[model samples]
Target: MNRKGAHLEGVFLDFPDLIGAYLNGTHLERTYFRWANLSNVDLANADLADANLEGTDLIGAKNLTIDQLSKVKTLYNAKLDPEREIALREKYPALFEKPDE
Candidate 1:
C-alpha cells in the first residue's frame, strides 16, 4: 500500500507484511513496529525518531539512509541491510551483541 505523508506517530503495528509499501514523508515517530516485515518498503523522509523496531525486517528497504536510522530509538534484533547494519553497529553495539549460550 502507498501511504505517503501519513501521520502514524506513536501507533502500534506489529508483524505487518508491508513489503514494497510507500511510506515516504510519514510521521512514524515513536511508533512500534515489532516483528514487522518491511522489506523493500519506502521510508524516504519519514520521521522515525524514538520508533521501536524490535525484530523488524527491513532488508532491501528503500530510501532509508544511515542518517534516518540514526535517529531511531530502538533496533533490538531488527534486520537491516548490510550497509545500514554496519553503520548502526558502531553506534549501537548492543544491537549486534551475541545471545548468551
Candidate 2:
C-alpha cells in the first residue's frame, strides 16, 4: 500500500491490471508499461523518469500530474483523461498519436 522507493525500473509489465494499487513514492524509472491498466492507481511522488508508457491506459489515475508525465521518456498511444490528454498534447504532441499505433 505505502511502498516508498519500490524498485521496478526497466521491467516488462505489459498488459498488467494494477487498478487502484497504491504506489506512492515507488521507483518506476525506465519501466516498460506497454498496455498496462493503471486506472485509479496512486502514483504520488513515484519516480517515473524515463518510463515507457506506450499504449498504457492512465484514465482515472490519481496523483499524477502533467509535469510528472512530461518527464517520462515515452508515452506513445497512452490513454489519459480528456483534460489531461489535452494538457499533455500541448507539451508532448508526439505522445498522442492517431489510431493508437
Candidate 3:
C-alpha cells in the first residue's frame, strides 16, 4: 500500500503538536500521527487527507477518519494555505480554527 496519500503533498507537517492545534481542519497536510494524545476533542467532519494517527486518543471527536490526524500550526500566527484553509472553514463550522476552544 502507498499509504493512500497521493492527494497529500507537503513537508510542513512533521510533528504532532502542530497537527493537534488545528484538528478542526485548517492546517497541516499529510501529517503522520505517530503516538499523539488527542483525547476528548470535537473533530467531526475534519479533513485529514494523509495524516497517520497510529496511536492517538480521539474518543469525543466525531467525523474523524481513522486514517486522519489533527494537524495545524504557525510561526507567529495562524498560517494555512489559501485554498486548504478556506475549505477547512467550510468543512468544520462548529469548531473554530483553534483547537483549545
Query: What lDDT would each prediction earn against the true structure?
Result: 0.87, 0.84, 0.39
Q: What lDDT tens digits, residue by residue, belong to model 1 across residues 27-89?
A: 999898988999999999999997888889999999998878877777788898888898889
What does the lDDT read for residue 44 in candidate 1? 95
TM-score of model 1 (CA atoms): 0.89
Candidate that scores best on TM-score: 1
Across 1-93, the per-residue lDDT of candidate 2 in tens digits comes to: 456678888888879889888898899998988889998999999989978888889999999989889878777878899999899888888
- Collision pairs in model 1: none
Q: Regarding TM-score, does 2 or 3 come out ahead?
A: 2
* Candidate 3 per-residue lDDT over residues 1-101, each given as its tens digit: 11221333343333344333334543335554444545434455455554444434444443454334223321112233344335545664322322321
In what order do the candidates fall by lDDT, top score first? 1, 2, 3
Between the candidate structures 1 and 2, which one is better when assessed by TM-score? 1
Q: Can you give the TM-score per candidate against the true fold? A: 0.89, 0.88, 0.38
List candidate 1 stretches off by more than 4 Å: 94-101
Candidate 1 whole-model C-alpha lDDT, 0 to 1: 0.87
Off by over 4 Å in 3: 1-22, 62-101
Superposed by TM-score, candidate 3 places the C-alpha of residue 71 at a distance from the truth, in angstroms, of 15
